[model samples]
Target: MAALTASQAPGVGLGGHDGKGADAAGDASPGDGSYDMELPPLESPNPPGGSAPGGVGDKSGIPKSVLAAYKKAAKSLATSTPGCGLRWELLAGIGKVESGHARGGAVDKEGTTLRPILGPVLNGAGFANIKDTDGGRWDGDTTYDRAVGPMQFIPSTWARWGADGNGDGRKDPNNVHDAALAAGKYLCADGRDLSAKADLDRAILSYNNSSEYLRTVLAWFEFYRKGTHAVPDSDIPPVSVPGLGEPGGGPVKGTPERGGKDGGKDDSATKPGKGSGGSRGNGDKEDGKDGGKGGGHDKPSPEPTAPHALERATDQNITAVAGETFAARPGVRAETAKGKSVKGVKVRFEIRGSTQATFEGGAKEATVTTGADGVATAPALAAGAKTGTFTIRATAVGKNLGTVDFKATVTAPQADKVTRTETTALVADKNGTFADIAVKATRKGKPLAGTTLTATLADTAKGPFFSVDQQGKQVRTPVTVETGPDGVARLSGLRADDKPGTYTLTLTAEGGAKVEVQLTIKG
Candidate 1:
């Protein structure tokens, strides 16, 4: 049980590199791995202006192969588990936390770690007592199991969750693709939607079962949520920030420190010794603080006085202009199981799903404690430049009533003026694709970015149709394209009909600007 989260289970206390046993974490049902009952208010894990790997990612310091692996896993999971709402950012958050993107992108082109990044053995001495489940197959330890690979999955969990994400036929935890997809599957298990805080908390807790781990992973999750750019696959040496992404923000015992010139050599001291952060919260043999490291050890997190349930206290649906504040402040109420008002319980309000919106300080999430009347109101929400609908999730932290989702919409003030960038007539032979079709969208002579232009035939019939291959069949349908930084978007794959005739194609931008193109099909 220690290996498969016997000690890493939620409420098992802060495990993973800490020197402590399982501590009571609220009313978490042991290994059930859900915080729907948490009463703490939803808040951002990353504080505003928290120090990040300054130059690593996109300034996204993630290695190219690692980034590709994350994205590839996410994309594959979307098709397999669309309800999971898995995003690459979550994988990056775990990768960043688990092994700092394979120790600062020290992996080969196939996304395998240059050297084995192993954790201290779970020998029941100071760490979780997890016996070998992979027969020393993955962790190379036949006596006891160890958390292995970039995602730091122990053998038992890997046995159940391992997947061949890269489709290499063999499920290898050392491979970033397989490990990342496995992490996504583990997080999304049991129909969990990552957009919800309760589900997200449970997913993370099931991985490490520590409040500190939850907070750290959430911090990285939110930081990545803001933005992450792909870095080059160049041989950038590993440079881990202290207490940023690693265990307790320091080096684990038996592992090379971040930014250390360890030359990607294999770890000889794989077994964590007395003072290393190998044990779960049971630090070193001396004082149980940060496994003998300089930092303070993780103490048992204080459980919150939770509320029973949460309901919308204000309008659940809101609308505002792009880049403007909504008139209605999203709010929710906390109640007990008996429907009694619960006061002082924190309710966290967070932006969820697709949209660019934030509270003050560009914070995508916020926490508000319930008032005397049991109601918690969030601050005014300012919509970002992106125009679309999304949900604002409210969770009664530490309480398991699930979450309340509020719908919000942001509208653009005006439509850009869309004009044809290519004046050439769209002439195509029957069944031939119309090539070199392009459009530019601008507002007041300035190019617009992220402008949506939907291209369609004036008449669905008797006109050249946009043919696209779907599921091995060619289907005719209208297509939408978005403008880039330069405000230009292009189109292709428009096929001509057998009847050679003149037709008109229209490209309409979201804000109402429309441009017409003449299409001539030859027989």
Candidate 2:
């Protein structure tokens, strides 16, 4: 296994590079058939980022004809072994690294110096014959005998494990399709799954028969995973923050109904109002404190005393206002062995994700810290963001610590907009009612009627926007539209049965002018 360190080269400035793996950084050979290139350290056999030159790695010096050939090779390899866990792009990177895209049949070779290039003959167990043809005999212990084909598979292992990856009847080790399949199989073989770091490390070791290979592969995997597109955290739609949507701190106080299997008690019922438990001993009535009698803390009759056992921290729930910085949320809860709140207990916070491994372009990492109220708050998030999930872990200055998880759900507050507004915004004024609103289509500020306006309820944000193409998924109800001669369209009887969130009203004018306004509705 080979361990390649990340390259420390600065950003390459290649205005004319145009995706070519050439001397983008002002280092080019004068028709010497060579070019200088800088790379991040090669700590792993896999490229640092999932991307390599020429759709796999940099190949600027190589002519476009060569790049086309390599791309064609990559496509064939990828399509051949859809079942293989290894990506063709990674395999292509290995090909570019091992043989310089050379597809000629195996050249008789031996020794570690040329092992990566002559991998096919060595790993295929036919090295002795090829070596004999080349007027050389195998030393049997050299790195040359261990090398495989384009992606470098060892012959002894490949002979038993090599597969017809492309299923083209010929298990040609020299062929990119076969070699890539073999590499994929070798990487994802039994007890080797790329998803797990340990398994991926093990698979990397098998590829080149070295621990260094495992390390390099891990580094490359990290780089690739980060560089590729991943599921975004903001895909979820914004919802109104609980207990803050209505006037006067939301819904007015109502009768306290016992929470049932359906909806729970309203905000006012559970709010921290007068006579609510606010003492530190709210978990119990011990020491003459004000809490439910014998609330589990009063008596610890059967408990065993263990010096190594850590006490459980109790502060779990925290509140934050929407659109405000989340830094007020406490990262840690102070507590004692008796479950009592411990003030001034110091704790540290940290966060992690797949993005942390590589260099990020100024993206802020989430931070957690305690405040005067013993609460930790998250950073101020951006607007229009729909999704976020975060975990706040706390470590006591000593060994005892705890963790809390939080997810952000954005509920866009009620706002009036000339173009887009929720339905509630239209009918929200209980004291004032506007009659028969007229919707008119205009082009260049002139009324143009006889147009069609289709209204659709937002299913799940983007879901509603594209629902017209969703076939049966969209609701069967239709939004009625009436057009007047002055290009005025009147729509009425919009019912509450329509899905909440953003509903788009698409207007298509007679002259093909079109516009869409999103309306949000609340239940």
Candidate 3:
């Protein structure tokens, strides 16, 4: 469920929308099931004054050329899903916000290409080592990166949501047409109703996966729209699925099938396996020696103890988001040395090292086994977890004893959420330092775009210096500034040396969040 929050106006600068709740547009019936209608082509809403679409220099930084590209792309997608009018400028805005209009090549911190919208590019050459090899490794927890191409779909997500828009057989998310169609299709499935406020808001939430995220996107939309209107219905085409009746209609089949050409699945959908979903490696093979040895050995036993040990219990691997709670399914394997299923032996899951933390395994233990199905789960942990490599040891004890090792790593969360709140001392010299400093806040390691920040500084003996406004304006008194899309605010040219003592910098944000720092000036 989306959290309740308010939507703030754009002029408020750094502070996002203050209004909360979904738009009350058309509502779908509960238990209505999924939509199975033949899908229509996508379309765009008409703008006010019917003026030419806003371009980059509309002073909004949205280039006219890019807007034109959006229009062209929207036209083609409209052919398949009618009543789907995605704003040309919104598409451009997303491109700008995500990957700097493809100029920066949307990359994670480790420099790996990310899909602008849908991603985790399945079947791509770089999927296996993406976590270790990519330059833009978000915080260490996220396996995906910023994204490449105009669409900005993260690689992993792209693997699941990508499609062949031009029918060229290649599902290139970087292609503008393909990306735009996917964006529109994603919104529709998420229940975006251009005509209704609630649906549109909910659709936005679906896009970012959070209510706060939806508000930020909408605020940006409002800023870009300024005088523009929604894309008109006339430009959109009706959906055309062979079996499904029409767009938004109930699903033709009870459930959307998996492993299809389009790759559309409900967010709440589940996959097969003994765990919550499935594991990264082979799900059914079990092989290794018993746990009679200690936890820190370098290699496994040379030969398999059970004849089918390698075939029954498959090795499990996971990349954990440091400081977050996650569960591993099929946590234990119920097998004997012969690879036979053990009916009543209780298996235990444990972790060792500086990476020590806790899970929801009922006790200090992460989890226990009920039967022979190899399954174990872990509880959530606190933030600020120690960063490094860790080992997960799975031990099974029935009449006989056995153990296995599955390698794992713990890394920081991606940039979406920032964990390190720092206070650095600034040196003031003969040259006056830019008094105004911008504090960029990140949530989940990703920049928390559009946050409002208020900075107050009191010199021990010098009193107040000057306050800078959001527009970089220097005012005589203290002032409040909102953060931009990068979650940054600047207080330039402060008279640090003039104070000659300890100065305290405090920042308070919306949602009642606050951060403070101390600065020392040396003569």
Candidate 4:
């Protein structure tokens, strides 16, 4: 793996540039001094799928075309470097920070940003003074140059890392897909393993020698990884500080504010200073320009440690008849070693067994984010078409958190039958009471007591069944009754209006059988 070259040209500004301070020296050597440190690694890989687990559609607020480009580049890199685990979220983070995922211009079907994105001119006033290296070929400036594209690559840097992400013949910085892939390649250089936090940080720093820049990028990265849309702040050019103002408070003669003046030079440098405040700089310089105050390359804060290992708890194992829904009580809880709750952790639920189970709520897979109570509930589990036992497993995001498994049993009833009682024809009278109807449930030729039975009338308008309880209140359709000691459930007080019609009643016994009967009511 090639280490990022230190002799590279001056960086395109990484943040807002106020042009108030003297220009940082150009050609300060990439990855020099404070920007020269190696990064540590995080524990897990943030994979590059469109949505978070169990989430669907585009939720990152990024344009579908741009997001697709990042995903493609990530997949290509990951496929090529088996263990690299490069993910699209990281690329998205960089894109968001660099250029709002190419929000500065119109992106066409070819994933090209119709408008060229350029940063401030690296004149001594506030940014590094880069004597134009592209010879007015890409940026059109024979003097100083600017950054370009969605990822904001200076011509020199893009030259070393430009890639063809869209399968097109040429590498174009204006094309988002190509720019994103090039950015990924640049980050993954030096054989840096992103799975570790240190390496990820180092890679991001190399992109733009700024600690704040790294933080902003990582924050967006986390949001993207969670399948949440995170809109980058507006790209208003930083206001020049009052006393530190430039000659005209505008860009120099050759360098343009928004894009390259001519196509001769590549305007791929980053924004000059930090946003709004215009406090930070990109930190590199060239020739004799005053070295701008680069954003400090400081190590990020340490990762938070849980006091205790994560654990899974369930109220009870699930038991249901085949084809019925069994609500799983699985709940994930994280704690410190001292038994304190660890909130905000993500827990994922997976089903495993000979029989398949569908997660309730139409989720392809169930995942929940832990709340303040440190618990996430799995959706209801529906048994497979055939009866059998299955296992539900709950796992935390990181390996440090433990895992738990729960078993569920689904059984098919044997010898269950529902029989309807023979009854005379019912009449629709002014008073509305009809003839009595009854049904019996049995399992293995024996009465099935304590079974709940439900009855529904096919046509509710013509003959509405109303049952009066001890309170004499009328209960409408879907009348429910429980089987007695003899396994008999009876229905009475069925009413029909003066308009006579035929009606069908459906009877269903819990865990038993279903039967429907036809009845005629005459006016």
**What is candidate 2's lDDT per residue for 425-474, written digit by digit as tens?**
34312222222335566444545444555544434332232223355453
In order of TM-score, best first, we have 1, 4, 3, 2
Clashes of each: 36, 50, 130, 53
lDDT of 4 by residue, 123-160 (tens): 54445566655543233344665556677676666667
The estimated TM-scores of all candidates read 0.40, 0.25, 0.27, 0.36
lDDT of each: 0.63, 0.33, 0.40, 0.57
Q: Is candidate 3 or candidate 4 better by TM-score?
A: 4
List the candidates ranked by lDDT, beginning with the highest. Answer: 1, 4, 3, 2
Question: Residue 208 of candidate 3: its Cα lDDT?
Answer: 41
User: What is candidate 3's TM-score against the reference?
Assistant: 0.27
Candidate 3 per-residue lDDT over residues 144-208, each given as its tens digit = 23233445444344445555555543444445455555555555553344547766665554444
True-vs-predicted CA distance for residue 107, candidate 4, Å: 0.7
RMSD of each: 24.6, 31.1, 26.5, 22.1
Instruction: Evaluate model 1: give its lDDT.
Output: 0.63
lDDT of candidate 4 vs native?
0.57
Identify the candidate with maximal lDDT.
Answer: 1
- The parts of candidate 1 lying over 4 Å away from their true place are 1-59, 234-523
| lDDT of each residue in 1-523, candidate 1, tens digit only | 0001123432234322232322122211111211111111234233323234334113345667888899999999899999988889888877776666765565666676654556555665445566655545455556776677778777677767778887644566767888899888877777778888777776776666666667766766776676555555534323222222123323433345433453342222233322211222111121233334442333321222335357678887899878678889888877642235678988889899888799988899999998898999998889888988999999866544446889999988444588888667779888777886888898778888878888878767565876645564445466899888898998876777677888988889986899999999896
